[model samples]
Structures are given as C-alpha cells and as structure tokens.
Target chain A: MKKIKYILLATIIATIWGCKPEEFGPIVGSEENFLKEMQGTWSLTKVTQVDQNAVSNGWPYKQLDITNIYPYKELVVSFQGDASGKPSTFTITPGNSPKIADLNSGNWSVDNTKAPTVITLTNNGQTSTLTLGSYANLKNGKFYLKREKKVNGKTILVYQYEFTKK
Target chain B: MKKLILSIIFILSATLAFAQVTLSPATFTAEDEVTITLDVTGTPLAGTQDVYIWIFSNSDLPAEIIKKDGLTNGQWTNSADAAKMTKTGTNIFTFKFTGTTLFGQSPAELINFGFLAKTKDGTKQTQDYKPYKFDPLVFVPMQFRVFPSKMDQTDMTTVYFHQDLATDQNLQRMFDVKVNLVFYNDATPVPAVVATRTALVTVKESNILYSYSFIPERLITLTAGTKLTKFTYQFTGSVKDANGANVPVAGPVTEVVYTPFN
Candidate 1:
C-alpha cells in the first residue's frame, strides 16, 4: 500500500509538470511576445547578412536616427533622420530580388541556441529559414534589438540607428 | 450584487454609446472667399445620412436658406455670383461666399449658420451642425484710394469724396465714413498738422458715390505759399452691412498738388 501511494503521487507530479506551459526565459520569446517586444522603437545598431559561404560581411551601414517597429496587421518599420524624427515606413523582404519574399505579416518566433540569439520570422505564404542575432555588445541598456541577420550566404551587420523609447 | 453589476454594465454601455462630431472651416478670408465644412462620423452609425442647413442672423431672427446652384438628389453646389450654402452629403456640407466687398468701419459682426441631420422618417436627429456657432469673426482690413480730378501748376486743388455701397447684394445699412488728408513732399508723405474732413456722407444703393470736398480755407495756412509741389492724402472709414458684417477701409490716395517748385 505504501509503494502504491508513492507511485500515485509521483505520477500526479509528473503529469502536472508535463501539462504546465513551457516558459521561454524571461522574455518568453513566443510569437505574440516577440511581436509585443518589437512593437516599440528600435535603433539599427548593426545589420549582418550571412552569405552561403558562412562568411559574414558587415556592410558600411548608416543608421537612421531612430527606427520604430510596430504591428499594423503587418510588421511596419519606421525611421526618421532628423532631430524632430519625422518617421517613414519601410517593408522588410527576405531573400534575393525578383522573387524577394515579403516578411511583413504573420507570426514570428525566436531561437536562443546561438550567442547573439536568432529570430525566426514567418509571414503569410512563405517563411525565412535563416535566423537573426542581436548585438552582443550592449546588454545592459534599452537599446536591445536584433541588429544582425544571416542573409543570402553572409552575415550583414548594422552598426548604428536612431531610436527612442515609445 | 446583481444590481451593482447591472449598474456598472449600464454605465459602460452608455459610455460606449456616445458619439462625437467635429466641424471645421476649409477656407476663410475677408475679401475673396469663405468656405466652411463639417466632418461627422461616430460609432453609433457606420455612415452619414440626410442633413439640413440653415443660416440665422445674430439678432435671433428667423434663419434663411441661401441656396446654391447644381442641386440634384439633394446635393447642392456653390454658385458663381452670390454667397450661398449647400448640403453635399449626409455628413458633409459647405458654405461659401466669394467676391464680397468689405468697406472699412463698424463694430465686429457675427453670422450664425448651422445644419441638422434628419432620419428617414423626417425626424430631427440629436447632432448639432451649427457652423455659425463655431464661426470665426474676421476684421476686414481698411483701404483708401485718393486721386485728384484736376491739377494746375500754381492753383489750389480741391479733393472731393464719393459714395460707398454694397456691390454684391442690395442692402440698406450704412456706416460712418472718415477720410484723412496728408500732404507729402517729394515721394515721401508728410503728416498733416490738422486732419480735415473730406466727406461725411451716408451710403445708399442709388448713391454709389459718397462725395466730400476739401478747399483751402486760408492761403497763409499753406506752408509752400501756393507753390505746392506734391499733395497726397489717405482715407479711412468703417462700414456695417445689413448682415451685421463690419468692414474697414484705410490707405493713401495720391493727387498732384502742383507741377514743381523751382
């Protein structure tokens, strides 16, 4: 009778643990949380597009004063160059041109396997198999954003951006 | 507990049921044109419906309908000749007055214009569309034009005044008119030691010309000793029209007093 009770208690604990929802770190990098985290303002600090050769080439990038990433049925990225920070919207597409896939709408997920962290973005009809990484330099400040991405076969890095907390 | 929940629900529902509408002026100017428009939309209705427009005098008189040309299926378009108001849509309407003369003088005036929406059953709705309530009072700038009919080398010249009337519409309201004469030497105008009244005439529709005359009262008063080289004057006055619109006029009217002083 003692053994049966112990077994029953162990089974109940295991069942509860299994049923409990998985927590993805403090940020909970789920699709909805990823969107919520990226909804505010973000400056382009570094952009890296990794080519097929696995070699990363950081382009000479000019960061706009501030960039705003907001959800409006689709992912909308806005930036302003002036001190007043008048913003204009831009669309992000994945891959090569002619057949450049739009990564504007749909769901997004983050993969934390790498050092910089990879963001997996998926849109309406297609998905980008490549992952993006945040800059490792600034970990203490609110300037947290995915500044680099693996594109084509190389890594492109964006070094600077103008962003304000919205 | 049920009553409390019911009251809370009623309050929330009432808060959500209220709607807001705003009206604005597209264009406004004293002389050339004035256009007013209303923007109406709310959660209570998806789209706008029938609307009625009316203009009332500030004196609480019965409002009048100033119709425009091109009316079809209840939509009205602005006319070319007269100031008019028209309904363009269930939520949008415009009142425009163009090419109206504003003579200087009189107290500031206000004209009240408004519109209302009606249901399909012809019942008045609850929205206030009075454009005149939000109407901005404008002060027409004064202008004066002075000219002499005759000029002699050494002879004294007299300045006469003319009448004023509303050129666009026939109305019988006149305002106090005043003209100041200043003699200028060379190209620059010289301030007069004393202001002489050129005319004190009332404006009448038949009398389009308000006349005033200025004669040299004494020869010794002339500083140039009848050898007046140049003479120019400015006129200023105020006018109030039948609609209680105040207009002001001010500016210089130039006339040659003499040929030249040797």
Candidate 2:
C-alpha cells in the first residue's frame, strides 16, 4: 500500500510537469520589414567617389570623400508607399547638388523585399538603377545607395550617397 | 725605410694620374658594353703588330690577385688570339668587352681592374698599368620607383609601378593599368593644368611590373623664373565589381620631389 501511494504521488508529479505550457521569446522582424522604414523624408548626409580600378587592384587612396566639396546637404528625398506597403513613388528635391538620380520624381520599385540590392526608378520610358550599398542601419535611420557610371560596358566610377532620416 | 715608403707613394700617385687608357662613355657599369682604348705612345709596346691586354684585379695583394681567363690562357709568354686587341689608330688599340664577362665575376666582386698593353713575348710592355672602375649597380623595387635616384628635371626620368608590390586590394586585381601624371611648378601650389596627361604604362615584367618614362622639360614648358618643384602621379586601371561590371580604378596620389636644373 505504501508503494502504491508513492507511485500515485510520482505519477501526479510527472503529469503536472508534462502539462506545462511551452514558452517562446519575443519575435524579431525580418530583413523585409526594413522596407517600411524607408517611408518619409531623408536628408543627404555625405557623398563619396570611389575609383573602382584602384579598389580592384588593391591600390590605396581609391576613395575620395567629397561630402564637403559639393552642396549635397541641401538635397532632400522622400519615399512614399501605398496602402499595401509596396514602393510607389520617390521625389527628389535637389537644390544645388548634382542630379544623382537625374529625375525629379519617379515611380520606384526594389529588386527584392527580403534583402533589397537595387532600387529602380522609372519615369516616362527612362529608367535608372541605384544600387543598394548598405541598409544595415535602416532601422536606426541611415541608408546608402551607389550610382555607377559605365563606358563601353565597363564601370568606371561609383558615386556613393548616404542619407539620414529627417 | 722612410725614403722607400715615400718613393712608393709617389709612384702610386703618378700611376693613378696617368691617362694611357680611355673608355668610351667614360662612366659605365660592369654590364655595359665598353670600348677599352690603349694609347701606347712612348711605351715599349708602341707600334707592336699584335698587342694583348694583361688585365688583373686586387693589385695591392699579390696573393689574392685575379686575372681574366684570356690573359691566363696566354701564359704571359704567347698571347692568346682572344687577348689580342684591334689596332684602331696609330699607336692606339681598342678591345670591346664587358667587365662582367671579361672578369668572370659580378660587378661588386670586381672592385677595380688595371691593365697594361704587352707583346706576344711579354718582354715589351707599358711602363705601368692603367686603372679603371665600374659604377655600383643599384636597383630597388617599390610600388613607385624612379630610375637614377639623383637627377635634374632635364634628365629622362622613368617612373615605375611594381604591381606585385601594390597593397590595395583593388590595385592588386586591376588590369590595363596606366599612369596619370601632373607637374607642379614653384609659381602655384596646385599641379600645372597643362602638364596633366594620361600615359600608357609599359610592362617591365609581364604582370609583375610596369613603367612610364618622361622628361619634365619635354612634358611641360616652364615660364621664366619658374621651376618644376614636384610631380604627382597615380596608377589607373579597370576592375570588375561584385555585380560583374567593369569599374575604373585609380591609386593614391604619390608625389616625387624634383631636382631642378642648376
């Protein structure tokens, strides 16, 4: 009888432990959710010109930081999204800066939502592709894009643009 | 003993000041083809039909002296056909040979050499041997190197870019490299706009090294009272990026100080 009582007690303890509910940690957003962070206006923070030839051959001084050389700080760019949270339109307010995008306003679309690599802008039949250089700090309010110039199918220069959320 | 030492010093000084032998292109390295000219005027070997060069080195130490194989082959009695010099003019003989080959040693090993004109019987010869020196061979490989380190603006200066010595990742992988050059004059702090040019960098060694040659005077015309103080240059090329697109690349700005013509 004492053994039976002990068995019943052990069984009761095992049932209670087995019935415990599983717990899960807080959910983190995917790289795709960073896209929504691009909405609203951003100001140009810095500009850099990279010599692709020098960079490729392991030469030093391949990059020239020209943030202060040009009036890029006056430029403000705005990105808008539709109700479905998809890329819609982008507007450029370039006061005295070089026309990096070459368009004042255009419909834009990202190459991928999971990890966007390119942002293609189209207006009236003309299209331009701005390569995504970095989005590591997108949630923290920083983004980078690169504009490349090519000659005879060869990329000769890359102009990098850094934008900070306003 | 003091009188003998003084006599020996005087003889040595007279021998050094002597000018029986003269080499064309007076200054040359051991690897350069040199014409050895011997003037046998007033010497016993003058007007000899077949004159030979008795060449040797390290004359200070008789035990450690080394002679050219051609002279040794003659055994100092019967001159070898190879040792016979060509009679170029009246009482003048010339022999065309490189020091490295004639001495069978490197330029560094041949500290200095002396030679005397002699006959087949070795009985009639010059009063004393004439001494000659070879300039030291110097070459230092770097990412940016200039030949003949000390030079004036008028001299032909060659700039070299050792691709193998490049440390930048972009420079290491770049191709079709060329040099972009610009000169700065004393009048302006900036480089001369007219002197800016892109020049082809010729390959010194396939894929390992490249060089570009230019004379500062030829590259630009300096105004009166102005001189070329320095020149800035960079190596430019093309490279492929991650997207498989060809990208133009340029190296860091390098400046070479100029030595203005006096």
Docking quality (DockQ) for each candidate: 0.00, 0.01
Tens digit per residue, CA lDDT, model 1, B68-162 = 21121133232122222255666454555331222121113433333433333334343533343322333222222221222222222333333
Candidate 2 TM-score, true structure as reference: 0.36
Return the TM-scores of chain A for each candidate in numbered order.
0.31, 0.80
The alpha-carbon RMSD over the true interface for every model, in angstroms, is 38.3, 15.2
CA lDDT of every candidate = 0.35, 0.72
The DockQ score of candidate 2 comes to 0.01
What would you estimate as the lDDT of candidate 1? 0.35
- Give the winner by DockQ: 2
> What is model 1's native contact fraction?
0.00
Judge the docking of candidate 2 as incorrect, acceptable, medium or high.
Answer: incorrect
